[model samples]
Each structure stands twice: as structure tokens, then as C-alpha cells.
Target: MSKPRKGILIILSFFAIYVIWGSTYLMNKIVVTEVAPFLLAAIRFLSAGTLIMVIAKILKFSLKITKAQFINCVIAGFLFLFYGNGIFVWALKYVDSGFAALIVATQPLFVIILMRILQGKKIQSKSLMGVGLGLVGMYLLISQDTLVLSEESSIGIAVIFSCVLGISFASIFVSRANLPSHFFVTTGYQMLTAGTLLLIGSLVLDETWTSPLEWSGKAQLAMILLIVFGSIVAFTAFNFLLKEVSTEKVATSAYVNPVIALLLGWYVLNETISVQSLIAGAVLLTGVYFINSKKKIVIFSRFKKN
Candidate 1:
């Protein structure tokens, strides 16, 4: 590919991740209004996973996996989707999507600790500072007053926090494990596994299924957008960008997601965003940047002369 073409593709791929993934919080908020969280999550993953498999087959990519691979994928799916995603959806009923995204944004802080705990990696002082900042951000975002609103709300915050930790561990595990060379294929299997497990969970929880015919236009649109853009296109783009660009650049999505989710939540749903949430979001984003970055940003360093 020409340099210009490559750059354009890279920009578009980043756009997909930043915008699509960010929009998904709002999408989840919309879908969960009528559909049960587990059922919605189950269907989303099952469909997206199937779509990816089909696309891979059409492209003549290998889709076959060993029995052990399937089992590993199942475990990853359970962590990444069934708990990380499914529980987040359920929590949205109590917490605002933007608030949930803010909590989810603290994922890198957990990842830093997980890496140290699991692999015996050394945590740097800056990384420790980042973790501290992230904790304060969470406290501010979920102010004591907010937590005292109801027991359900407190549980929701806790569940979302757990999901962040769950996904952090899942990512570390997937990286260490021997999986398929095809990233999408691995993602497909993980989604399928999570989808299947969550489907069972839906039945176990006695969640009612609302027919497609009965879904509101907004709900239907949210599902379609989430399946097509959020799961397939954006995720594929993210995996692609990991290969093409510096991981530091790709990690910028961590900061961008909350802003997009917050704006969309406020604009479309008119969800109220508190000043504390904004301040906390800023702190949380700074912490994530510190966690991902190897060097101090020294803010506005781009303007410095070489």
C-alpha cells in the first residue's frame, strides 16, 4: 500500500475504535430498556460471533480450532463477555452509561496490577501514581451521595468495577495463552462461547424475551449498530491498529470513550452529568495515560523543538 493510503486506512481504523466503541455505552442503555441485559448481550455476541465466522470462511481464512483451544476460548469468553459485558449491561439499569464508562475506563489501572501480580512484572512509581489517581477518580465519580442513593446503585458500581478487573485478567490470559494466529477467529470463538453461556444465564435467570417485532425503533437501531459497528468493525479495526500503529496511540481510545459516551448520553438521552463526574473522568483518563505510557507526556510536549 502507498504511504498515503496506509495513513488514511489507519486514521479510519482509529476512528472506528474511538467512535464506535464509545457509542456502544449509549447503545447498551437503549437496548436494556426493554430487553433483558443477559438476553441482549447473548444475542449480540452470538450474532456478531457468527458473522465473524462467516466472514472468515468467505475470505478463506482458517476457522478450525483444537478442542483445547475451544475450552480456552470458552473461559476467555466467560470473562470478557459473559461477565465483563453482560454484567455491565445489567448494571446500566441502575447507573448511567457515561458513569459506567468512566468506571470501565479505569481498566488499565487494574491491568497494571494484574500484570505485576500474574507475571511478577515490576510496577514503576508512575504506574503506582496512576493507580492512586484512578482510585480517587472512582471515588469522585461514584460519590458517597450517589452510592447512598440505593443499594442497587451501589451493587451496580461494584459489578462494573468487577467487570473491569475481569476483562483485565482476560486480556492478560489471552496474551499469555497459545491461541489462533487469527485475532478475529479468537474473538469469534470467545464471543460465541460468551453468547452461549449468557443465553443459558438468561434462561436460568428467567428473563423474558421480547420479540423483535415489539422492539422500539431506537432499540432495534441500537442492536444493529452495536452488532455491526461496535463488535465487528470496530473490534477488527482495533486489532488491526495494534499491528499497524504504536499501542500507545491505540490506547488513546481509553480516554476518548468516556467523552463520547458522556456527550451522547447527555445529547440523546439528556442524562445529567455532574461536575464531580467530569473532574473524576479527567483524573481517571490521566491515570490510564500514565499506565499505558512508558514516558512522561509532559503535556504539550508536541510543541517542543527537537
Candidate 2:
């Protein structure tokens, strides 16, 4: 593809990812009240994964992968989807989706720390500053809410943070793992494995699914949107962008996602956003800017050498 065409594709992919993922918070907030969170996530991913895999087969895409690649996908699926997103969906039961998204936005900081520990990568000064800023932002965001921190919300928050950490660790493995030649094949396998695990977990943990079918139709529509646009389309666009653009650019979705979630929560859900949350959002954005700036510098230096 030509440079201009590739650039446009990357931009469109990024836009789709940001918009769709941002809306997922609102969708989750709607759905959590009716559908069980883990069960809902399991169904969404399982259906989407099956659809993608079938489409790939119809298109004559190769599903034959190396044993090592299969194992890698399973491991990443366990970490990223089963643990990461699983915890996220569960947390929605206790916390506001907007608040949950703010916490997840700390993912970049976790990724940096994980990279340093696992890869022995040196932390750039700017990234260190970003971490400090992110920590302060987190404090501001959480302090205004109830300081008592009961058992349920505390556990929910801890689980969500663990999910971010798991995703960070899984990403490092993903960078090094042998992958299938076709992106769709790889994503299909990962989603299938992860969704299956989530389904099993949900069945084991959750009691009888008692949510009535007569609830608000709007909530049901939101769940459908979560499955169709948020999980399927957004993820496909994210994978496409990962292939076409620098990872740093693709990572900017973290910043865009929270802003969209915050706005949507206010507009659609009528969730209150305080001045402190606004300040924290600014700080978080600055932290992401610094983190990505360092990555861009490295990319530019490599390009100049080439």
C-alpha cells in the first residue's frame, strides 16, 4: 500500500477503535444490571470469535498454526482476555463504568513497569515522570469517592488493577510469541480460547442466571452493541491498526478511550463528573503523552538511521 493510503487506513482504524471501545463502558453499565457480567462477556466474545473464525475459513485463510504459536495464543488469551477483560466486566457490577475506565487507563504505566522488569529495559526519564503523574491522577480520582473502601468495591478495584497488570504482562509475551501468519486467525484463536475460559469460569462462579427478559429494551440493545461494535468491530480495527501503524500510535487509544467513556457516562448514563475527575483526566492524558513521546522518539531515531 502507498504511504498516504496506509496512513488513512491507520487513521480510520484508530478512530474505530477509540469510538467503539469508549462506548463499551456505557454498554457495560447498561448490561451489567440485566446480564451477568462474566457471562455476558463470555457470550459476546464466543459469538464474535466463532463468526470471525468462520469468515476466515470461508475466505480460505489458513488456520494451520505451529504448536508453539497455539500455545502462545492460549497463554495470551488466558492473560489478556480471560483475566484482563474478565475482571473488567466483573468490576462493572460494583463500580461505575466511567470510574472503571479511569482505572484501566493506568494500563500504560503498568506496561512500562512490566517491560522494565521483564525485559530489563531502561525506563526513560520522561516515562518515570509519567508514572509519577499517573499515580497522582489516580489518587485524585479515587480520593473524592468513599474513602472507607469496603470489601466489595475494594476487591473489585483490586481485580481490575490485576487485569491491567495481566494485560501488560500478556502484551510482553505477545511481542515475543510466534503468531499465525494471518492476523484474523491469530485473533480468532485467542478470542475463542479466552471466551471459553470465561464461560467455564462464569458457570462455576455465578449462580442461576435470573435476569428477567422483560427488563428495559434499551439495556438489551446496549448489550447487543457491546457484542457487535465493541467486541467484534473495535477489536478487528485494533488488530488492523497494530499491523499498519507504530505500536505507540496504536496505544493512543488508551487516552482516547477514557475521554469517550467519561463523556458518554455523563451524557448517556447521567453519571456525575467532578472537577477533580477533570483534573485527573488532564494529568492522565499528560502522562500518556509523555509515555508515547518517548516511544515516538525511539521510532524516529530508528527511521533516521534507516
Candidate 3:
């Protein structure tokens, strides 16, 4: 592919990822009302992971790895897939999809802090400002009457925060660890490991499995779309794009996803979008823009100097 064509393809892949994955949050809210949260997530990841593994095998993708690489994959699976998505699934049981999405969108802010702490690097001023803005946005998201002081709401907030922390830690660890060169193959292994953990958790914690499925046909269809498009296709595309595109460009998905999720929640779930949400979303996006833009400006300046 020509450079321009390749860039366009990467950008399109990112857009697909943002839309599909963002919609999954609302779908989870719909489905979790009927399906067991852990059970549903287990099924989604297991199916997607199995399909990816089979494809990798058929393509003759090598699993050959050093012992260290295997360890890295295992840790990443636990942190990213197991803890990240697992907590997210749990949170959906109590929180509105829009609220959950707003919290999760703070992942980039967490990632920056985790990177600084783990790497012992000095924090950038822009990044600290982004973190502060994200914190303010998060406060705005949960300060409403809907999210106040109930036990379930508190638990849901904890779950969402746990997921954010897990992703932050996982991202930093993965940055320094040795990973497979084949992105699909690596992601397959991580997904498989994470899915298995979720399955085990479901079996242990969820005692009654015989509850009649209570979802409408529409919700069922949404679940299928979540697994196929959201978990499998979108995630695969995201991993591929990460390899092809700059991280800053890929990170734009963070901003795009919240907007998509908010709109979907409003239309499908009939959730009210508060003015606070709009303002917070805009502020969060602005912070992310400044943080990423600073990097680009630095690179361009060096190029000009050279």
C-alpha cells in the first residue's frame, strides 16, 4: 500500500474501533439486566478468543516464545483482560452505561501516572494538567443524583476505578515487557487467558445458572454484536492500528468512544444527557488534545531544527 493509503486504512480502522467498542458499553447495560454479567463477559471473550486463536493457528502463526515472554503474556492477561474488562463487566451491573463510559474514558490519565511512577520519570506538566482535568471530569460524572450514595452505586464506582487502575498498570508493564511480534497471536493468547479467568470466576461466584433468559430479542442481538464486532473485530483492528499508527493518533479513540457511548445511551437507553456531561467531555478531550499535541509539537520542532 502507498503511504497515504496505509495511513487512511489505519485511520478508518481506528474509527471502527471507537464506534464498535463504545457501543458495547450500552449493549452491556442492556444485556446485563438479563444475562449474568460475569457469564456474559466470559462467553464473549471466550468465543472471540477461541476464534482468534484458531485463525492464528491456521495462518501458521508461531507461538514460539522465550520463558520471559510467556510470563509477560500471563501478567498482561491478568491485568488487562482479567482485571480491566472483568471489573468493567461487574460495574455495568450497577451503573448506567454512560456513567461507566465516562469513568473508563479516564484511562489515559491513569496510564500517564502509572508510567511516571513505574518508570521513575518526571511527569510532564501537560500530563499532570490532563490528569487534573480528568479528575474534575470524573467528579462531575458521579456527582449527580443518579450516582449518589447507594450501595450498588458505590460498588460500581469501585469496580470501574479498579478496571482503570488495572489497565494503567498493564499498559506500563506491557510497554517494558517482551511481547510477540505477531500482534494477533499475542492478543489471542491474552484474551484466552483472561476469558478463562472470567469463566472460573463465574463458576465460583455465580451459584444459580438456571435463571431464565430475560432479554428481549433486540438485547440478544445487541449481545451478539458486542461479541463479534466489539470484542473480536474492533479489538483486533485496534491492535493492528497500534502497530501501524502513532500512539497519539491511536489514543484519539479515547475521546471518540465517550461521544459515541453517550449518543448511543441517549437513543437506545433513553438516558438523559446532562449539561455537565457535555462540558466534562469537552474538557477531558481538550486535556487529551493538549497532552498529545505537546508531543507532536516537540517532534516537529526537532525536525525543523534539523
Which of the numbered candidates is closest to the native, going by highest lDDT? 1
Q: Cα RMSDs of all predictions?
A: 5.8, 3.8, 4.6
- Model 2 has an lDDT value of 0.72
lDDT of each residue in 59-158, candidate 1, tens digit only? 8889989988888888888887899877777777777654775677577667666766766556678766766776676667655343223447778888
lDDT of 1 at 166: 84
lDDT by residue (tens digit), candidate 2, 112-158: 66656765556567766766676676667656765443457777788
User: Which residue runs does candidate 1 get wrong by more than 4 Å?
Assistant: 1-18, 91-106, 135-145, 149-161, 237-256, 270-282, 296-306
Worst-scoring 10-residue span by lDDT in model 2: 297-306
| C-alpha local distance difference test of each model | 0.74, 0.72, 0.69
Clashing pairs in 3: none
The TM-score-based order of candidates, best leading, equals 2, 3, 1
| Tens-place lDDT digits, model 3, residues 1-306 | 698887687667876777887788788777776777677777778888898888888999986777777778778888777777776766777877657766776776666555556554455676566656755665565556464334578788888888877866665565445778777777777777778888898898863443335668876787788778887788777666655643333445666676677778888878899998788678767765665564634211211111
Write the candidate numbers in order of decreasing lDDT. 1, 2, 3
Q: List TM-score per model, in order.
A: 0.78, 0.81, 0.79
Flag clash pairs in model 2.
none
Give per-residue lDDT, candidate 1, residue 254: 62
Error of 2 at 9 (Å): 3.3
